[model samples]
Target: MAYARRLWEGYRELLASEEAYDPFLLLEAVEEWPVFVRALRRAASKNPAEALRLAKEVWREEVPLRVLGVRLPATKEAFLAQVGLA
Candidate 1:
């Protein structure tokens, strides 16, 4: 999707911010998150509606959600590719 080259790196940079978040929150965010949900939807069934549900569920409203300054289709894996993580 051609997100900015830095978006992937910036996503990785989030690892450094681990200390800022509550560990429980991070765990819940990951397990019950829309991100993972969409990922599962794409992997297991590929249902568009289920995928959309996951996207909305995981959407972080309290925290400003950004698209890595890249395009929406630009996922973490794709972003990593830009930085050679792939």
Candidate 2:
């Protein structure tokens, strides 16, 4: 989990920088975890903008773990319910 957090921080930093970032690097950092990749894809499919916002919140530890524990490959309804949006 610490390693994942560090990767997320690095990814965030790259995005914040003025220089162009590598998509492959970001993919490598994130795509190694199939569960996370699935959850992210699901979130993005539902709402791209919100998914990006949530990614930032996740890195900041602003989102509660309970909300995040909706289960990997979660149904849209399940995801919404855990986040109190259903």
Lowest lDDT 10-mer window, candidate 2? 64-73
lDDT, each prediction: 0.37, 0.48
Which model scores highest in TM-score?
2
What TM-score quantifies how close candidate 1 is to the native fold? 0.27
Model 1 residue 53 lDDT score:
38
User: Which ranges of candidate 2 are over 4 A from the true structure?
Assistant: 33-56, 59-86
Error of 2 at 3 (Å): 2.6
| Residues 8-83 of candidate 2: C-alpha lDDT, one tens digit per residue | 4654564456765466755564454445445655666667666655554553432322232322223545544443
Candidate 1 runs further than 4 Å off: 1-38, 41-45, 60-86
